[model samples]
Target: MKKITWLLLLVLLTATIHLPAQRKADRKTLENLQAHITYLASDKLEGRRTGSPGEELAAGYIAGQMKQAGLAPKGDNGYLQTFTVWEGRETGEASQLTINDASFAAGEQFVPLPFSAEKPAKGDVLPAVKEPDNIWLIDVQDMELNPHAPATDKYLEKAKEAAENHASGVIFFNGKEDIGAVRQWLREKPAPLSIPAVWVNRDVSRKLDGDNASGFRISMQVAFQQGKRTGTNVIGYIDNGAPNTIILGAHYDHLGYGEDHNSLAKGEKAIHNGADDNASGTAALLELGRMLKNGRFKNNNFILAAFSGEELGLFGSKYFTAHAPVDLERVNFMINMDMVGRLDAAKGLQVGGIGTSPSWTPLLRESAEDMQMHFDSSGVGPSDHTSFYRQQIPVLFLFTGTHADYHKPTDDADKINYDGELSVIKLVYRLIEKANKQDKLMFLPTKETQVSSARFTVTLGIMPDYTYSKGGVRVDGISDGKPAQKAGLAAGDVIMQLGKQPVSNLETYMQALAAFKKGDKTTVTVQRGTQQQTFNIQF
Candidate 1:
């Protein structure tokens, strides 16, 4: 009885005493993460929009934080690695419209379309047709172009027909009441389109004779310029007396003031605080950096990089990989954190790039212990990790998952699940520790999985699971009220055939979707387990 009591006491002591130390460390880490997110996602930062003053503020704050945390400045400049991007926008004065004899004011009576060229254009206005040699005009006063669904069926059809027929450009006739919406929409598309395009109000439209529309000469001058905006990537290098380098990165940029085209909300403009989108990831990176500063590692020096311009494109990461502060060849592995704020502990965290190295799967599994996790074998994903992965370096991407507030103005700091995110960060920290102790991770090229960033004329509104390495595209998510959802397409449905085309991969799927137009009826075949089901989709 005495021996049994002693054994029970020892077991209880191990559970109570030994684990509290880890818990205390984790609590401090969580606090650090929260502090970072609070500042980065704050409204004063104005959504951390790339190229904006807000983004510069964020970069400055990050650098200061890193300095305070005792991180060695690894950036070309002191805690700042600068890169330039071709940022262009419509200059208010140069963007003007003159239809017939009436001159229209910019951003009011008339505004250039998102796809319009910056150069001056004067051409005869004609009705849209199969092949329009002159500028095509489309009147959308009677059509329903909702704020959410701005690209109506008729609008898309017209655009597609014009593009297909090799039309020079298009002019849309929107009423004066919709000027604000039009401006909001145009602001989203910062770059020029295939051909020059413009939008004029009905007041200007009234000036044109319906019978002799070809008689009207529309003169438009939309000016845009490419200038360099300087931003920094806050980098910290930890010297562990090891020759091998391991990089950990996260993009700190977000869509500022819903000005960028990526924002989902329309009409009313607000600051798109990208808390979960990336501030979360940036926070995780900071916390990891702080821990690693004092943590023990047998081998591998660490590079903690907080990148900018990820919202613009993968510009920051791409530049970093190209102009690597450290040798790229010696990089043992890379870990990227993006959108890790809203972790659902039950559904488990997702770890991508498992197939980037042969040892990744086993290493992740061994380090994860009983933590709930979904392992994805793809190296290519929409994050900073892909940049390193492309350079033949092993990578692991941590994502908490997408939410309704993704890329929207409503994605604020208050929505972050701190405890859940802390759990995810802890898991990643453990994995990194394990990786550093092991032999240099061998980089393995994963099978080419086509990621669908394709622009399509029509879509069934299904989010394809790019990580699924299968013969057919798997429908991981069905967008609500979309054609696929209305057609009885559910999540987990593996799309085998779209129309008559065999949907072999994401590329083929895009081709099939592009072949369709709105209101066109097509049969979609999906393999749900052993059964093949056919459903009709009206796009």
Candidate 2:
């Protein structure tokens, strides 16, 4: 009895000591997360939009943070992995629209559409007449061309109609009421039209087609230059001279002013400060980099990567995996954190890619005891992890579930659940800790997630390279046993056409997919390098 009292006291003392230490560690993690998210989601970063100056600033800051964490630069350019992204089209300085002798500004008054022909066009223009060998001027006054409630479907219809009517060129002019702003380029891939299509502003419209004016001979030079921006990925590594490396990643890019039109905001472009959307995950990634860089694991080297253009469809990750500095065969596995900030006790955290490896189920169960977790087996997702999984590397994506402010300007740093995020980060560290004890886990292919970026009834069983802005839906990876794979279409093949519909970009591809049912049979056309191939697909 005398010995038992002292033993109980010692046990109590040890428990008390550890409780405070745990709390202190948690406090530190929360503070660090807040600090990172506050700056990243601040207005100064301008939403950390991919390919913008804001992105560059965020990348530099992250790289600086990595350097502070004692991580050696492992990227192509120090800590920055740069990839080129197509930023739509910009009107050339020399491009102009001239109606007879009246000339107008290239981008201001008359803007050529993305598919507009780049050749000089000279023809007679009459607003009321549709004749062969004439540049037809169509009055969009009564048309459903409300720039606010943007409907560009009519533009293609008009272009097709004008082409069938044998018009040399097509000029669209607005009537009495202003039609908002005329954006020259559509963000997504647009099919090239046979004839030139130009939209003249309301001011230019009245000058060319006044109520009293007859027909006039028009000569116009249409030239558009492709816009490009360097997309950056921040990479830091802990080289322990291990046989394999473990990759931890998160995407740091958010929509800037909703310019790409992926925002849920009703009207007027606002800076989409994606704090919960990804600032949370990125902050967690930075903290992990700091915690794990000490080489305590002793099993595998660590690669901490913050990717950009994930919101634009995993652009940075695809490029990074394609041009990895290390051997792809030696990559152990990848862990991706997308939106792990908004963790709610009631809502819980989402843990995906459990099925990618047999090791995940037991280990995730061991690590996920602190909170409610929804586990998914498939490695493919809507985030950067899919890029790794597509390369046949094991992957996991941690998410805190989406909120009302998702993809909106309202997703600010003030809304992040700091304590909850800390818990999530701890859980991830625990998972990695457990992983470090074992040898490099074997990779296993899992079933593809039905939750596609394109929410259509049918699937082509292909992952689209969202950043491929050139033309068509570029196939990044073909799903196993899917229509694309079964049809002999492989990765890097550009889906130029699906059935009778022409697939230009993701939007067109989705639209074309939506038109078909599961049992429908169609001819799939793909651009494979220099040669074009067509295959029969039943989907």
Candidate 3:
């Protein structure tokens, strides 16, 4: 048995010595890349939105392709790793409101607020008045609200103030103008309150306008149902019976109808077919999987991954890293391709994470024949590769740079440069083959991507969950010796207030950080579960 194992290794090593030329980068490969991108970026796929049916179709296609390519399933469930995108909340159709013996529909005439408590309420609705345990009718004559203190002006805050006034329920309506904008925000998923709340439309508002002094009997039920969707990551493995494994990954998800507010397109809604944004990378991944399936490079195993929910803050990759299919220690390094379709000889192909390992530059320089390559030292960037880098694994991220079509409906499949993308896939294959004979790549940490984007001198040293849609930024990580860590900030702490400014999202957090200079002191307020805690800290 020992002799047989050594002989097999010798055969594999001998094949390495012979250095069989990798599959030729030719017309067939370019055609294959074009076909994959065209299908993935088609209108039928609906831009491959994460957790949507369109994304499910793309996942199935990729899985089938992997099966046909003869790669074994390395995921938890047959070449697919599924994870929850979000557990949002929405008002059920059963929710209704009635006043003065008149019925109002749940969606058309009236709608329940997202944060409202799901409870039935029966009481007399009085206009412009607040009393103990009775519904108060607020006339939609725009209340003079402080712009700077929007937290106090929001519906949730007003509901809390009404609770303090001992109101059983609150009903809002517009008397002076249309409340269409107000009704548009009737979404669930926020933190619910103890009292039920509903907003009445123009028709209902006109009926309730006569009763400044008269009392109207009200009956209401606000039912909120949880909404969830599962996002799948397609994984394919080439088992060479080697010790360490190499990961080549790209995210396949893109904006569908620009619903997430990340789209740069304005006007009427249209599908943000991210052909160059991600279909390019995903197609490249498929081609690379096929290229490596042959018994050419056998020193290390390979995992080809097409991630989902990348546009939604790298959720798919993060989940994959947390619940890795193989022992993380056996992983060699990760190579990520994203938006690599628009390569220009003049601008060059951008190659980041060069500083992740000492051998990366030398290997990259040796591998390049006539390709124009650009480099960055940071191992962390705005891509799926950043997830592996965070796990202490060396990583490389490839891109062709952003264009006018970025994050917009104009980014259609026809706009993709198939030849440029084929070159990228070929480059990734060469890199992997070059490192097949060497030992596992050594990992070295470098400055994060935000260092170049967010320019602030003061350090809070907290990692906020950029994907968090809930009210304020939630702490996902805390760095040692930073202001937040020293001030008792912990992971899961939702930062509500930063000094004098309110920290809402990543943008607001950066804005709040801009006010403070080095050595400045301020108070930071965070929501720790049911409790809101404040801490004093120095920059």
Question: What would the TM-scores of all predictions be?
Answer: 0.68, 0.87, 0.80
Tens digit of lDDT per residue, candidate 2, span 265-354?
Answer: 987778998998889889999999998985388788899999998887788998999999788789999999999988889878888898
Q: Please write out the lDDT profile of model 3 over residues 255-348, one tens digit for every residue.
A: 9877666788877779888999899998898888888996499999889999998998888999999999888888999999999988887888
User: Against the true structure, whose lDDT is highest?
Assistant: 2
Clashes of each: 4, 2, 0
| lDDT of residue 14 for candidate 1 | 92
User: 1-539 in candidate 1: lDDT tens per residue?
Assistant: 99999999999999999798988997888788888898999999999877788888999988887887788999998888988764433335777677778787886777666556666656765554423566676666655665633352355556556766776666777544466556544433333456666767777776652665656677777764333466668888888879899888999999987654678876678998899989999998888888888888749898999998887667788789889999999899999999999988688888889989998888887788767889888787677887787788999989989899988888988999999888777787888888877888999876434344446667687756544434577885565678888999987899889998777656467767877777899999999989999998898
- Candidate 3's C-alpha runs over 4 A off are 1-25, 87-95, 98-115, 123-134, 139-141, 145-166, 174-194, 199-218, 223-227, 451-459, 466-497, 500-520, 525-539
- Relative to the true structure, how large is the alpha-carbon lDDT of every model? 0.77, 0.84, 0.81
Candidate 2 colliding pairs, count: 2
- True lDDT of residue 182, candidate 2: 45
Prediction 2 global C-alpha lDDT:
0.84
Report lDDT (Cα) of residue 237, candidate 3.
94
Q: Measured by TM-score, how close is model 1 to the native structure?
A: 0.68
Every model's Cα RMSD, please? 10.2, 3.8, 7.3
Candidate 2 differs from the real structure by a C-alpha RMSD in angstroms, to one decimal, of 3.8
